[model samples]
Target: MVNIILAIVLLIILPYIGLWKLFEKAGRPGWEGVIPFYNIYGMLKLSGRPTWWLVMILVPGLNILVMIGITVDFVKSYGKFKLVDHIAAVALAFIFLPKWGFDKDTKYTGPSASPEFREKYKIALKKTPAREWADAIIFAVIAATLIRTLFIEAYVIPSASMESSLLIGDYLFVSKVNYGARLPMTPVAFPFAHHTMPLIGTKAYWDGIELPYYRLPGLSDVKKGDVVVFNYPMDADSPLYRPVDKRENYIKRCQGTPGDTLSVVDAQVFINGKAAITPLNGEMKYTVQSDGSEINPQLINDLHLSDLTPVNNTSFKMNATVLSVKALKGYSNIKSISPDITPKGHADPLNTVYPELFPNYKITPNFPDFKWNVDNYGPIIVPKRGWTVKLDSLTFPVYGRAIEIYEGNKVQVVGKDILINGQKADSYTFKLNYYFMMGDNRHNSEDSRFWGFVPEDHIVGKALFIWMSIDDNASFLSKIRWSRLFNIIR
Candidate 1:
């Protein structure tokens, strides 16, 4: 009890210890920085921010930005203008500010960013052989991390879900800034690990200080038919809670945006009742009949037909792009090629193999008759911010998981009546925008049709292009996909 009390007391007093010295350097009474609002008022005076901006401190999310701005200005007042200095001011202000304030040699020049400040404080790291290598590696990691977090990240296609449009082993540069870089919700995490730590198989992130979801202003809002990368929302089921940015990343085509009604009929997607434009490179699994002969290895290789499974001597199933399928039809041995469409009321064979699809929840008042299959699915309206939907047994199966899980609400069903958060409600208003994502290789991909809506917060960014592509099945010389290099993703 005494230790806990001491820790709490230390936490309360430590910030003031740093602030008092920092305040004294700013020509304010040292003791004044220990007071709550008075400390902020003193900071405002030192930062040169208008006193009216002080009111912003009371606001929740805005206060963080205001505090950051004020701190940056305070560091500028000390003539620290380098990017590294700004980073230190924002990230390690408590330690750095106190050190700068208390040190006899470190003096505050004025409220101006001076070029001389750079020369005075600039670190000249000792140039030993070991130090040179360490510095290079450290700076390289920092540069790569910054580029990944703020600009674009290198991604490898790990599955055939996108097939010819994007293949397994294809290296891509997903533009973080294109769809607005998502500020890390779990900032303190292992570098380069997604969800799990490498080798040891531990959680990759420390979820101790989770921040609310926020995206930097983007070049454009996600549009229908846009190739997108997003955190898998349903991964919320995987043992522990993961912040939005730390969840597993997935790549897919945006089938429906918020407010757009979406459905799949015979594997054709319709958005807002119009046929959505398809990607030129998009592919789907097809059942093809051939003239009872072995398929030419060269033909298969040339067309890049993935996972060609022989059903009989005369027929096979393969995932091929539209152009490849057209090319395959040139062979006289190929008789028929058509989409492997799963009929309505019947589940796809993958459904049996995969155990569960999206909305993979098992809740009471079970939606047993909810026979939504991949090829033929909802004409359901995609949930939009501020849109209200009548809640009942029928609609519950469609929107229940999102409302309860994603939106963080308590949903209950009592004798055919729906209640939200302990209150009887006939309708529920959506708090966040939602999106529907589908894979380009329609038949082979496990996507929104099998799962459910992807909340906007889960979106990662737009996939820009393939930087490199390699085919593992080919020889070393042929492994590199020369044509696919620098191919801009559509």
Candidate 2:
């Protein structure tokens, strides 16, 4: 509260003080510069600009661009048209205006923006080549940074979780505008580094000036099947504290939207009691049995079947896409090929169980006998904003992590009751919407079924296009996946 009050006071007082002195230096009544809209009018008159520019500054989004142009003109009116001067005009205006207006060495010379005035002063204020290059690079970084924050950014597929749909080494251009670009929570950070500072292996960002989660207007709403990029919410504090936007980025298909009931039966996803349509090209593990002879290696390459594990030579387990599964059936040496699906009621073998699955079913009593596994998971409803859910021993395990960690509330389970922040509570009203995300590689991917729901605040953007694709296994001539380049990601 005190910080907010201090910021408000500074916003009100600093501009008034700086602009008053600036107008005085321009031969106008200093008090006239402190009067809201009138101050803008005075500024325009001194810079030889029309009053219509003020209207242009009032429009949303465009106001920022128009105001920057006006500031450049104002700085030029004082005979400071250098790149550094323009940067000071835009970024340090509150301080720079006061310095320029009060300094005895700086004097107003009718606007220097005019070509005649620039040419006359060019010799005395000319910049060296090195300095000019530095200035250009600085400005370019700023422009690119703004576009990355507000429009789109390039991302690369770091893993094969979304195999066949999105592959490893595929370079993508993620569109932040699809689900609205999130304003960076921790704005001061090492450029181009996500979590670690380059070369140092230390933290990249400062959390001192953290901002609340905010998103700009977006092009479209996130839908059921859209491939979405989002911050890995689980990594918020695996080893160190990090802001929301700086967490690792993970891409997956949106399996369930808020308020939708979602479940997995025999490795197939279902939403609202109906089987969700799987992506046609999605890959899943399948057990393949061949005739008593070594399977042809060329056929395996043609089908793109990989990660083959031999089961007595005659049979093997491999991750294969739908098209690959169809082609494998046509091979004379192949006897049988079927999906490696776990039975609905059975638990995975002790060696195959992933202990980190959500709700951590291993904790007893709080979650007595949770038979749910990756293949036959919940009919749990995704939480929506303002929806209230009753809390008890049974329900607590399902949402305990969400309320305590993500929502930042203190929770306790006392016998049959639940306490939130030391107060006995029967229910919890979700503060944010949640979605279910999963990789296209059904049996191979680790996603929401393993970690849990993705809170709305963690959403990053829509996966738009694959700008480039490289195949590590291919020889030089075919190293580039020519067909995949420039393809729009569905």
Candidate 3:
């Protein structure tokens, strides 16, 4: 995921970062310009070089060598050529040349390069294959996507929120056949903007202008407990946020079916009041500090990182073992109850799974041992079709009216005041349906609690397995975590 982010950042920001460094080294102020070409001029000036060198940049053959020479000269003149930056600047042109031209800090002053600079430069570029590989990757991704979307789409995991099952960094080949492949959403959407119009898409032609497509419904019913991804419906006016004019996809495990009464008590999930037995509950994943050493956060009792609470900022918890209840209505924290899973050889005792239901108690949370957290918050019910719910009536402080409402043009908004297709609703009676999703590393994720329910359109596909599990929390090689690779997601 981080690599993907870095690649993407390099794509958009590299041009600017490269331009800035080049300009600064040329002795021009970094902020003096924005356009790519003008920035090139700035680079010439900062390096005490001439404007005439600009012609070489556009030239076809001798220009490549001249450009690399000039780039090396500028960096060396400005004292910005660290060992790595040199490799990035000349050898890895696609990877580093632009990056050198734009992003580095050319703020220092040093002498020019020696006579043998070009000879050494040629060798450095040959050694690091990441650049050439990056080029091949781009071509491969394009070719694969062209063949796949029109033919298997590739999916990459971005986080360990799906841990214990599918480790972060897992990649899967999602068959377009399963969901009957959705046509690209932004077929006509303006590049960065989501509102005005869509980019290249193939939906039906309504009257005159082009209409991008919406996928025909259902390859199969999205099963209960399947891991899925979908466009964020709460996406709207959020700055720098591209609307899901294209399907904005998110991956999460489905935990509810339409109309299933759901609740969380003591950090455990209860569907229709029966505790769910997730294969890896309270599983430990270790992370290392900035220095090269590992820290099993779950073992740090004082840190309280492991306490599953129904609320945010669990770092505030004082005692790992003491989750004292405060002011919840009709509820009192029962002390000394253990929520540890039963011994591996036997089934859990029934008492550990279900809390007693009562008439006065509107919320019977499932968590008996964890802190007050999202995984510990519900005993709340999910509404189904024909299930009439009164706005401002229930005690579900977590829910009301405004949810991830889609208004077209890939716009989505969330709040307490929204309606669907012109129907006034604080809550819906359900025209289609809704589902609940949660992360596997349950306690530390920002999920359904922050966003509203996951609507059907947002559904992607189940994450079936893990192909790789690189623990970001380990020594570089030790971080590979071989045991977790190829693990099956339950």
In terms of lDDT, the best-performing candidate is 2
Work out candidate 2's RMSD over C-alphas. Answer: 3.6
Candidate 2, 1-490: lDDT as tens digits: 4434544444456657877887788788999888987887777777777888889877644566677777777777787767888888776666787788788877667654556666777874588998789877975776677678778899999888898899899999998888888877776687778888878798888765566677888877789999999988778656755677888889999999999999999878899999999998788889988886776889878777878988785888999998989888997988999988777667654214466366666753556555676678888888888989998767777777778777878888787778899999999999988889999987777788877888888999999999999988899999999999999998
Better lDDT candidate (1, 2): 2
Candidate 3 regions exceeding 4 Å error are: 1-143, 146-152, 173-176, 189-213, 216-219, 245-248, 281-375, 383-389, 392-404, 407-429
User: Cα RMSD for candidate 1?
Assistant: 6.5
| Cand. 2 TM to true fold | 0.86
**Order the candidates by lDDT, highest first — what do you get?**
2, 1, 3
Candidate 3 local lDDT, 211-236, one digit each (tens): 33445444566666666666555553
lDDT: worst 10-residue window of model 3: 321-330
Among all windows of 10 consecutive residues in model 2, the one with the lowest summed lDDT is: 348-357
C-alpha lDDT of candidate 3 relative to the true structure: 0.48
TM-score of each: 0.79, 0.86, 0.45
